[model samples]
Target: MGFTNENAGYIAAQTAKRFLDAGYSVRGTVRKLASARPLLEDGLKEYSQAGKFEVVEVPDITVDGAFDEAVKDVTAIAHMASPVSFFFKDPEPVLHAAINGTKTILNSALKAGPQLQTVVYTSSITAVKSAKEPHYVYDESDWNDYAEKEVERLGKDTPGPIIYSASKVAAEKAFWAFREEKKPSFTMTAINPVFVIGPPLIAPKTESAVGETIRLIWTVFSGAPFPLPVNGFNFTVDVRDVAALMLYIASSAAGGPQAIADILRKELPETRGRIAEGNPGKGYNKEYTVPDGEIDINSEKGKALLGGWIPYEKSVVDTAKSFVGLV
Candidate 1:
């Protein structure tokens, strides 16, 4: 239940739509209801939402009791409000916001009463294990203890990506630990998504908008050079799937950001000249140019499906269509 006037955000807006379409009355939280509500409502106009949808102001989610009133009557919750851009050199602020903001929501959920059943948190795959060089396959049993240690030893000197991974590692542990200690009746599930990219449901047409992950693709379409390592390192989950909490990625699937650049070049005419012509067929798995000592991690699709996922190409095309005029 997070939104901003300028950036309603893809996952946030889509999560709200999924709930509303499923007939749950939603009481979303916003910092400023005046501007955010109109945009959120406008974005959901396509749905014949069965239940009422409304929003309230919860100025700061990190504050204690911030969600008390907002969550009082809800049964299930999808909490994806933590920011990913807090790449501050100071880990305290990042840690505090991620950890404390998580507790604040769970605390409110605890007080929300006996009907509450599940609280799905938007966790990162980094929470499983950081994708360091010599990438390895990670299963459900792995925890990113490496990031925690690296951050601790390096302190502010730790890379921002590691710190991000560390915070998720910390926050998800904190989530499960709270459950084990407190033994709340409601179950908690953390959805760990890898590099989230897809059509942004609510991002504006402006190229400068901050929230959509697809904007990275925009940078490429605008003639920026390939913005990733020669062999791209990211595995993606669609923002909509992440929002819906329907991911089923096993430890054996492997595609990266470079795949998107290639997809865009093939699908979007506007990007034909603007995007780079990487080795085309030989890009992924380095049938073309494998980096020295690099390894690939693979994953199978998860068995469960809230319907199969949106294919990456469709996600890419729709994302490009969403920004149709901007190039």
Candidate 2:
């Protein structure tokens, strides 16, 4: 489920593909039925023809009972609908939308009752990291409560990045709190990813974060000044891997590490770079380092829940290849 046709296509299309491959029918929600082109792309049309895929229109996700009908017979929910662009002038609306939209879905799920087993929400690394202070390492236990307070202090004037980070924090915090308060029968899990980058299922016409990230690398190939951030590196994950993780969690049994009902971290790469090494302005900006401890990709939990990490290098290559002529 997503706001625009293109915004959620990358992960949504991939998630549907994973389920279709496993012989499970999918009922996805879209804001506008007319704009849902990505889901019908590739061989999904065949799945639709076979009656394995269907989409219901849910124009407003923040409204109560928005997903009541969508969840009627479905066994699971992948609540991926959230704002991506941080260009909004005011933070309150974004915060409200994030918190309220999540509540609306969970409420509908509760109304749907026992059939719904799990809900895998797409969270972000923003929910875990402290925007003001740098940490040596971060894990599932970390929460971005500081960022939420920062947003409250600054209100509408909060920076786009801060508001965007706080939105995730607020939404995820609301989810856990709702689970504790409501104690609904279904299990809930969050896949907290950082700067998702990979080949989109369908290449987008307008430049998006995924498109722009791939374009940044193209600048290096053309010998343009590719400004590699000198301060800190963002942890990155392949979109495919994140979608697969969602599927694994949604379909897996109710026990093991997932039984604890906590947020699961996506695998991280060792380093980050877009352009050539030793560029003129590489080390000039000394903001602070964003620390990440190594994720045990081979650990029992990871091995059991996710198809192992897709290397960032491959993600970069595939992203570049996907936009070969368009970019």
Candidate 3:
């Protein structure tokens, strides 16, 4: 799902690659078949065999029964797609798309019957925690009720991040609620990934064509002012890890933008003057960068999910090299 998403495109393709690599057929869902088909096909061209991959359109994901036919006979599902547009200025559309898109899938999954043994939901760290929270360790049980309250109170005035936080919370809640109430045969699980970083699996044609996260990294790496104001929350995981599974804070933090600049300069000499040296001598301090609410992670659990973590340094360097290689 969301095979064309700026952030999730790689996830979708990589997920498809894993499935196709294992000799299973994959059916990807998109809002528009014409625009997304070629992109997904091209993205998975290396690993997907002729009859092993196909795409179907589910133009309106918010509607009930939208995924009925798409879900038919499928064994497992990775619901990584969402219907919300990137311009999340309006809360109503965001809420509707997030909640309803999730419901529609659950409804279709139920309609698919016992054949569907698993439904792995694509959830964000936003669903688990909010930027507004102080430094504290968070685990899977936590919920970002702060963002939901703000969305309810702030409406269109809410900040973009908070709005996104609220939407993820609501949608994932909707997903779990359906599972608990319906008790469908599929095992319902939501993978809540933090700031995702790494080189794009599919090379973008232009700098402006990269995903939102990489775009943010590019803004800082190119010595350009942020296209928008970003906060100082920088905890991160690699995009490849997120797909196989699944940064904002700044200076002196783990996965910080300044860290990206420094790595580029150290690993790629060409960045000497091309990228600004915001700060030097900083190290990757996970505890220092841990959000105020804190975090609780099981080394074994995380390894099982992403097959072990990809170091943030590698993710940063690879992202820079990818952008430089972009046409």
Candidate 4:
């Protein structure tokens, strides 16, 4: 279950579809039933006939006990809600929402007790890769030092991206802390995906960080800017793949957070060569640098859960195709 509709992007929608595909009912949280219905309707249209999806209104995720009622009797939760935006005048709000919203859900889940066996959280690659510096190889073991520093020094004047990164780091950290403190019976898994790019379940009208990533490829296809690739943004995974990975983790009775995180780490780069091959050649602007590192996500636990990742080229192609329809 997602925390709120507005925060639930393509990833959340796609993850919900995976659950429905597995013959499970999905109950997503939203601030307003009216606004969220159209999006949910579009995303889960195929499942509507099966009557597997519903929405619960939790207008304020930061409020204590906000998710208490919504989580009751739920077997699993995909906590795919977090405030992310391109424009935030101050970092405090973003930090507060991400950190507090996660705590609120964990608290409610504790109250949920026995029925909640798995809690899957949507974490970002930023949580693992320090965006400030290029690491040769990053894995589930690395927590972004840059983000940790931002969280330590969070104030009114932090940069938007840093704040966003820190929010992710803080939230994930909070989840682990809560898990240790509360020691709930449920299994906790966190899926740390890179800049996810693929055809959205429902197309968005406005540009977002995700939309911009799609546009970057289009910029190359159209030969608009014959310049260089944007710096430090080399990695990406398909939204659908990320969704499927989450589903696999949630469905796996023995799956834990590290196993889930490790699977993606081990498999994403295997598809890296395809990214360059799929590119139109013009898309490879020299300005940006590709990440350097070999992450071995091939643990026995990860292998038991799933296979390889979705091809990067396929994800970019699908994203470009979707962008054409958007404009």
Candidate 5:
């Protein structure tokens, strides 16, 4: 089941379509029918055109019995539903939702037992890399140590944006711990992506994190208020590519959790550059500014395991041009 109608939802729908096209039945779960209408319509349309797609309404993760009904008879599960927010004053909501939501999904999978053969958990690069460190590059092995401290310091006197990095780290640790203890019958994989950018399945008007980022880039290029942060650098990945990888991981016989992480790192740099270049209407400052911190991802393991999922070389420029209505 995928969460809200954002990047994860878009990617999940695309992955479901591929499965449907491949002659497999696909089921998607969302919190509400109203909010999920766009995805439902898109899925229904795809199924109407070709393939089998079904969207089921599931209770919010915060509620009890939410996962019970969602996981019934499912052969595999993609646990991507988690609380995602750009800014937060309280960490409790985000942290509770993320941590508890993961537990709920995993618990459901555990209950499903042998019926669930594969489970893919969507994680973030925030869980792996520290923003405080000046490391030029990072790999899957690195964990973000500075996120919590920064959040605490920034929010010392007042409510501040909850550190997503800290929440991710805690959630991931919980997931691994659950996996080790319960020893579920299914194969588990986690895909950690950096800044995800691509053509929206909906449009530029939608209020999404990626959309907002795109809008910011637009403002920057259009010569609007351009207070570009010089202290933020991150890797990027196309949503389409991420969706393809998720599907591949779901279906691949040889690939597993570690393999997924490896691929992400190996492809990080190329992906980042592509997403940045894909910003449409490019007329902003030409100066390549670096943030106060550096985030590097190494995906060598992914390449080695997945037989080299090469990132498109023109991804950056192409993405920028496409975003700017040039493509």
Candidate 6:
């Protein structure tokens, strides 16, 4: 089962299409059968006449044994069903969900380790570093300093967004711990995407990274209540690229976690961008630039293994057009 959103779902759909085209049976897991029906119907209509798309309902990730029955008979699993939200009054729920969900999935994978050859966990750049430091650059090696985060929480001033970053850090740390202790037989890989944006496979109603990006663009151009962050920038990759990378890792005989990190390093530069397409509002003199002193994730290792990392410039343009109804 995979998480579906405008950005991620589009990529997931594309991935599913590729697999189905190769004549592999595809089953998608959804939290709600009713909400996922549209995606299922569309997949059936677009991908195949054989109705190979199957949807299995799973318990909430926060609950134990949520994936017990779901993982049965599955050769490989891509754990992508985690919380991705920035608007939270409290971080406890989001943090618990992310950490607990990962634990649940990893535990289940360990139980199914004998049959499973590989499992790809979808992580994020949020886990790698934070945008708080204006002059600091971040790369794959730079882990977010959660210790500093705790200090901030105790300080007089604390921003809610920091909670999101903290959650990612904790979850990633938990993942590594689980890996080290249990050392499951199956190979594990994690894909950490920056600001993932692309075309939507399911459409606007779906809450996805793609949809959220479009909403941000609309807020910028339409002169909404909130203004775009002038100093805010994100590393991005095309949903297609991410999906392809995930599939490659899952299917490849040689690729591993290090290989995935290598790919990310080579691809980071082309991915950084401002939240909006055009210039900032008046008096917003500061423009977002790639921070210096941060670790560069695009390394020779990534370049050698993943070939060339391609940026999705067209995907960005297409995303803008979709929001403006020009697509």
Highest lDDT, which number? Answer: 3
TM-score of each: 0.84, 0.78, 0.86, 0.78, 0.72, 0.72
User: In model 5, where do residues sit more than 4 Å from their true spots?
Assistant: 1-8, 48-51, 131-136, 149-162, 205-210, 220-230, 247-295, 304-327
lDDT of all the models against the reference?
Answer: 0.66, 0.62, 0.68, 0.63, 0.55, 0.54
Give the CA lDDT, 0 to 100, for residue 321 in model 5.
Answer: 40
User: TM-score of model 6 relative to the true fold?
Assistant: 0.72
Model 2 C-alpha lDDT per residue in residues 108-137, reported as the tens digit of each score: 988876667888788776787664443344
lDDT of 6: 0.54
Off by over 4 Å in 4: 1-5, 131-135, 151-154, 205-212, 218-223, 247-304
* CA RMSD, predictions in order: 3.8, 8.9, 4.1, 8.1, 8.6, 8.7
Once fitted onto the true fold, the runs of candidate 3 whose alpha carbons sit more than 4 angstroms away are: 1-8, 46-49, 83-87, 131-135, 225-232, 246-253, 283-300, 304-307
Q: Which regions in candidate 6 have their CA more than 4 angstroms from the true location?
A: 1-23, 47-51, 131-137, 151-158, 205-210, 219-226, 230-232, 247-306, 310-312, 324-327
Model 1, span 153-187: residue lDDT tens: 99989877778878888888888888998899988
Model 6, position 203, has a per-residue lDDT of 52
RMSD of 2: 8.9
Q: What TM value does model 1 have? A: 0.84
lDDT comparing candidate 1 with the true structure: 0.66
Candidate 5 or 3, higher lDDT: 3
Order of all candidates by lDDT, from best down to worst?
3, 1, 4, 2, 5, 6
The candidate 5 region of ten consecutive residues with least summed lDDT is 248-257
lDDT of 6 at 70: 69
- Which 10 residues in a row give candidate 6 its minimum summed lDDT? 249-258
> Using TM-score as the measure, which candidate wins?
3
TM-score, model 3 to reference: 0.86
